[model samples]
Target: MEFNILNQSPVLNGHSVEQSLGHTTELAKLADRLGYKRYFVSEHHNMENVIGTSPEVLVTHLLNQTKNINVGAGGVMLSHHNPFHVAEQFQLISHLAPGRVNLGVGKAPGGTPLATAALQHELRSDIDSFNDRFLSLKSFVDGTHDNHKVLKISVDTESSKPDLFLLGGSLSSAKFAADNEVNYIFAHFIKNDENLLKEVASAYKELYPGGKFIAALSVLLTETEKEKKAAKEENSVYSLKFKDGRTLRVTTEKQVNDYIKNTDEKIEVEKSQLDMILGTKDEILSKLNELSNSCPIDEFMFHLPTADAALRNLTIETLAPIHTIHKEKAGIL
Candidate 1:
């Protein structure tokens, strides 16, 4: 199976934003040298801990730092930006890295309602508008829009468009992605229902047989019981469903409490462990193999949830494609 990385650039306690971003750059470089297929960064805003606000900017920096690995947004939240501008930005990045660029888009706001409002202050960002925005972005990127006759996304005729990916976990999202004939990545870390994953995968595959279907999972490789216990605690996430159909996901109970205190809306709280593969290197690989056997996942992208730099690096090195191949050849896998 192919392996890719989805970095959140988490800023742990006492770690500066610069340090976190630098570590991300180093990890991307490591993944590139290790024969990983792609290294994508996430988009989050208004969060003190997780700070990957601008995926396009990070993608450009990572592309300049790495050689062969495909780099792009794990996603750019389409709800917060203009489709035309999004297409143009990624297309320009594609010119810099050619086939090594990817553009993953998602329907979520990627932040709190406050941040969303701030980001979309000048745009119509209703939830129902995501489909239209995505279609416009796709058309612009593919050079199929009728307006292309009068305007172009990129002035460079030789520039290649980035490969497009839609990030979602629901069956409806699967259908949408299939209908659009774009790559689909199921966010298993967010909602870890295996049967649902299978159904979504089957749905997408039946409709778009040739499209890529990836599963992004939260994972950490641990060496001791202490680390394993801590990793497990960090693997939990709280999902709050508000009365008005707004959902908020946070990692800590403190954040959940803060949200409840700040909002007057009634919410149903559901706390679940993130579907993370946590164990030694061998055990982790075994779980991945079992998951692959059960689900029709075309690629596996690891989302290291820990803020510990050493553990993150170790996880990346342990799961590197080259290292995995070496172990397989040695009959140690």
Candidate 2:
């Protein structure tokens, strides 16, 4: 029942890069102070709305700002990078932060098709091949080079590799993560399917031999009515982007219906319902309790709303109690 923070450092509206970084760092610092378990940032490319393109750089900056909180990429887009290079870069970061790093990786290309192509360049491959490369990268991390011809990762520095978490919004990722024996983090917000989340987690657990699987949920919590409306508007549109690249905003029930009328894709109401963990503290906590009771989620990564430093700080303050409840339930303290 442990809960941590996962952020995309969203550049909402037309926020500058500096503003996004400042806001993210402030949130990380707040998370560290609030006794939240860890704070992870995501990776995206050419998404003007998101500033989390370089998780490597983000992790480095976050580590500098926070003392106790574990910071790493909620994932590096593994479908893009050379496995060997990714392994080395992560190993280096692990050395810098030691035990305070979590190396989460994802198979998603992460962004529009053009952006994906640019980021992946010639490294793109089918899901199977991409997963095979992930396995190769993991082997390198474990210091097992028993069968290698030329290319390999060996860090001269006196530091261990960070703990690995496989991130996904799909069942394929769950199966791959389980087979590879790494922890899994389901991107529930993007996937918008609670049943699928459970199914994936169940599959991972059934395949894994007593391993960890985390069901990371993205949430937007607020106190006041105005704040709540703003959050809903933000989340509704953000959720719509996953469908295709629709620009229409959807907040109210009517707006959601209207958006549906404009698009060919049927609106995933059940999945969208899963994203509305937005409300007062008690209301959101109750929802989380229900989620934990149904899903075998070990950790919950709360992706707080980030407009700027003030809003981000307000979110952490308001959401701190929920995180505490999760920690207490897990006996973390």
Q: Which has the greatest TM-score?
A: 1
Looking at model 1, residue 320 earns an lDDT score of 83
Model 1's alpha-carbon lDDT is 0.86
Candidate 2's TM-score: 0.81
C-alpha TM-score for every candidate = 0.93, 0.81
- The lDDT for every candidate, in the order shown, is 0.86, 0.72
Tell me the TM-score of model 1: 0.93
Q: Write the per-residue lDDT of candidate 2 for residues 1-333, one digit (tens) a residue.
A: 566888888774455878767878888888888878889998877555677888999998899889998898888988788777888887888778889888899866565456665765675355446677788778777766555445446535345778888887778778888887888888776666789988987888889846677766656666789987776665544244435332222334554454455446544553243365777767777888898888677778887654545666665776784455756667884
How many angstroms is residue 9 displaced in model 2 relative to the true structure, after the best TM-score fit? 0.9
